[model samples]
Target: MYEFFRDLDRRWIFLMMFLCVAVPIIIIGATGKTFPEEPTQLVRAVFDEIENLPSGSKVLLSYDYDPASEGELAPMATMFAYHCAAKGHKMYFMALWPVGPQMVDDTIENIIKKDFKDLKYGEDYVNLGYKSGYEGVIKVIITDFTELYSTDTRGTPWSAIPMCHDVNSVQDMDLIVNVSAGYAGTKEWVQYAVTPYPKLRMVAGCTGVQAPLLYPYIPQQLHGLLGAIKGAAEYEALVIEAYGDKMARKDAGDNPLTDDNGDYLIPGKYTEGIRRMGPQLVAHLLMILLIIVGNVIYFVERRREGRR
Candidate 1:
């Protein structure tokens, strides 16, 4: 057994790791099923902030990541948009990163355009698109929005958009939902917008590595936070659990019954974060097993060498 383990090809371990991730993904994708999640306090706080908002409340969604971090960040973005749309909040989409606008568009297309078709653009929601000044843009917009954003992404004047009619600055927003991957993201919003205006409520979702750095601002500058895909999964679970049946009824035009296992027939797009967690969980377990096996082999060989 010692010799066998010692001689085990590195390629075999690589194959095991690949299978560990791929199999769960395939199963979850095919079945539309995902492992259950228990939301952390921070995740629940994010859900509560959006849930507690009255219908028709104005919400500003800042997408601060690009395609490179989409795999980690997009799920939360989609969930945030979906939750706000379902709650009947008026959304104002904008970005600090150059490619952030595209992320906003993608979320709108996938969630609002696809599921909630009754929502009208420029009234219920508007895409303000990307701005170039980073934190500087946040600093300006906190006081006077028109100082920078005079037009929406489609070249329509901000004055023309019904949603922007009463908006003078970011202070007008009932809540701010920010999804960020790096610099000039949640930190910038917290510093330039929420910190200065204590009444301006904010919540954020960020990459796993960035979560720790932003925790200090929570409950004060940031109302809540979602960290990486795990955080996204937890938030998604909360939203689906609360609103899935209502959404199903909306689609079927009547009350819809649960599936055989007592689950709502929610769309796959809404479950992206949950589905992603399956592979992540499996991959982590596989890595732990591999580490244990490697250590056993190392110790066994050392003992043999000492005896000889």
Candidate 2:
């Protein structure tokens, strides 16, 4: 019996883990059992900032992630675009990483292109694609965007972009959102964009590994943060609750859905982040149980040795 359990193939454990995650994902996909997320203070702050803002506010969305974080960060970023688009805000898109451009493009393709087709190019929003300089780009963009990106991604001059005309730098915006993955992301935005320009309100959605380091800056420097898939889930809940109504207004051009008005009916691709949380919660629970069982086994063996 000891060997039966103790010498279990490593593949079995792996299979268990795979099923633990896979089952929840499939269940959620079919049943759509999303755990209710009560917005934390940080998440509330992010939601409220957008809520309180008047329509047509200028929002700078800086994509600071690569492919590595597209799973966790992409959903939040897409929702960020969705929320801003729903609110009728002008989104100025830019990226810091080389691959960041692709992430930015994903949002444009998925959210802006499909949902917000009414939004015009170079007028309602602009995409200033990735720049090589890390913090240097931030330093320059704090004062003048034209210094770094003289032309938009299409090789059009900044002056040609209706949204880019009066937009001098990060300071010109009402609020800034830096969706980051690593070193050149939210930290750089906070330091160069928010630190010097105190008036600039900034929020971030970063990867799980990097979330703890950013806690120190919370509420003060960063207005809100979406930390990993959990953060994305929370933000996803917020957006769904608040703006899910818009899907009901879908006209002939909209994506086909069974019940566009009902919850989970529209089925925006942003749900990926929230869906991941189901597996994460179950996996963490399994780990906790395993740890307790391990401790029990250790303590039992220790007592038996003492008797010998």
Candidate 3:
């Protein structure tokens, strides 16, 4: 038995892992069921910070990412936009990377434009677009916004936008929310913006590799963080649970899952992070089982040697 187990083919292990991942994903898609997730203090802090803010609070959202990382960070961006809009916060959008502007625009189109059509541009929300200064932009904006941005993304003068009138500098913002991918992102914002203006509160979401580097700043220089997809997934569960209940109550007679037009109302995009979590959970369990089996085989072989 030990010889057969020890000589198990690598191909069999690979096949098992493949099934372990694929089967759960297929089941989740068909049934629309996901593993339950409890929000950690890290994620809860982020939610509470936003939730506690007064309605109509000024929020600056910096999109320092590009399309390549959209898969991991998009869900987080959507939740941030949705939550802010739902909370009646005035959202000011901007970016550091040149491609960052497009990411900001995508969030507006997908989340704000689609679901919250009542939100007027330049009033409830405005996009300042991409500025070329990188971290230098953060430093300047910390003190003066109009110095770099005299106009919103559309080329309209800042004076023309009602919201811009109130935002002379980054300090005027009630909160700084950033969803970043790489260099000139969270680190730059931390060093240039938040560090100097200790009174300014901030929260952020970043790719997995960047989380550890940013963790040291949490609950102090940085108020809260969504570390990666897992953190995003946990946050998603909390937001959906709250929002879903509110929607259901409003549509008391009709299906909460669908709009008045009989079309599906709940955007599937909102659930991306949570949906992906199902397969990840199964894959991790399979890995742990494989490790246990491997260790058992090693011990059995050692016992055989001792008998000899």
Best by TM-score: 1
lDDT of 1 at 178: 94
> If candidate 3 were superposed on the true structure by all CA atoms, what would the RMSD be?
4.1
**Candidate 3 wrongly placed segments (more than 4 Å):** 1-22, 246-266, 286-308
- Which runs of model 2 end up more than 4 angstroms from their true locations? 1-9, 248-264, 304-308
lDDT of 3 by residue, 1-308 (tens): 65766898999888988988789878978976777779999898888888889999999999899999898898899899888998999999999989988899899998889878899999999999998979999988899998899899899999999988877899999999999899889988889988988999999999999999999898788899997789899888878776764333235565466556553344567888888887778878988988998999989878989999
lDDT of each: 0.92, 0.83, 0.86
Model 3 TM-score is 0.84
Clashing pairs in 2: none
- Residue pairs in candidate 3 whose N, alpha carbon or C atoms collide under 3 angstroms: none
Worst 10 residues of 3 by lDDT: 245-254
* Global lDDT of model 2: 0.83
**Residue runs of model 1 more than 4 Å from their true location after superposition:** 1-10, 249-254, 297-308
Tens digits of lDDT, candidate 1, 165-254: 999999999999999999989999999998889999999999999999999997888999999999999998999889988655344556
Candidate 2 per-residue lDDT, tens place, 1-308, comes to: 54445455778778878888899989998886677777787877887787678999999999988887788788889888999989999999999898887888888998889878899988888889988889999999899888899998889998888888788888899999889899899898888888888888988899999989898888788899888888888888888877765743455886434453345464648677778889998888877876786676677778889999
